[model samples]
Target: MEKNKAYFVVILIQLIYTGMFLLSKAAFDVGMSTCIFVFYRQAAGTLILVPFAFITEGKDSSPLTFMTFCKIFGLSLLGITTSLNIHGIALKYTSASLAAAASNCLPAITFFMACLMRFESIKLRTSSGIAKFTGIVICMGGAATMAFFKGPELRLLLHHHLLPSHAQLNVAEGSGSGSIWVKGVFLMLLSVSCWGVWIVLQVYNS
Candidate 1:
């Protein structure tokens, strides 16, 4: 019964997420500026949270020191601004399916970053290292497949599509009609890097 319940919850999540994906794509189809979209997201969140943060923390709260502010700014810029800007802009030049397929490599990127940080490691004699390293290689192969391969390659081999994907909308304006797919890839990579740093910082903080 518990297993069935878990499966039902998972299915529900998938259905809701799929609906969200299509809705967002529809928003993009209907025309929205990336900046406006981002602004709305931030402003709406701030509208709700700012008062809460202020009231809960207190009027004389000194949590946001210069260094703390810097960290927040850096995170917002790197993780949010750079990533979302590039992602939205890139989407304008590429297909939603393609972008979604490409972004899935993100987990592997995080795993590799974790290994680099000594949070995780590989040892040859042990099966664990070899297994993880192999998984990493496979993940890279998947990313490369999305980037370079044009056709429905490997579709027959895998039951489900192993392509790239993400949750973003509001394609950016400008750059005057060029292949921004590469730009998308670069932004995704940059976002992954930022996420890697975030994970490292989180580990350190903990």
Candidate 2:
């Protein structure tokens, strides 16, 4: 039952992420400003989550020091604010699929950072180390392929027929700019790295 619950949660999380990517891309295609979209997105999350957090944990939460508060503020600025803004811009310039696929590198980036901080280690002589190294290589390769390669598009009647005419036109127009696509990929990777740093910092602080 516990295992089933975990699997269900994982599936739900994936669905949420997929919906976010698709909806954000659709909004950007319709000429929504990335900055404004991010603002609304963050505001909505705060409104929904903050009250629940207060209700659940407020009384039991430990006292926060000024230094701790400063650290939290800085981490939030670096990790959430900057990362989401860049991700929004990247989603605007690139396709939703590319942004979602590129995010697979988060574990690789986080592991590498953890090793640098001595929080984790790799011993090449061990099988688990070898597997970890191999996985990191594969993740990096996948992200690189997404960033640098653009294969021939598959134009199915179903694809075009399902989307509105304007959406179809937007799709065609969105994929035409190679330079901006490259820039967006770079920014997306940077955003992922920032998020990885955030993960590592949270672990370290805890």
Best by lDDT: 2
> Pairing residues by index, what is the TM-score of model 1?
0.63
How well is each residue in 17-110 modelled by candidate 2, as lDDT tens digits? Answer: 8889988987887788988998899899999999999999999999999989988998899899999998999987787778878777889999
- C-alpha displacement of 39 in model 2, angstroms? 1.2
Question: Each candidate: what lDDT?
Answer: 0.62, 0.85
TM-score each candidate. 0.63, 0.88
- Any residue pairs clashing in model 2, and if so which? none
Off by over 4 Å in 2: 156-176
Name the lDDT of candidate 2: 0.85
lDDT (Cα, tens digit) per residue for candidate 1, span 17-70? 455444444455457786777678678878999889878888777765787777
TM-score of 2: 0.88
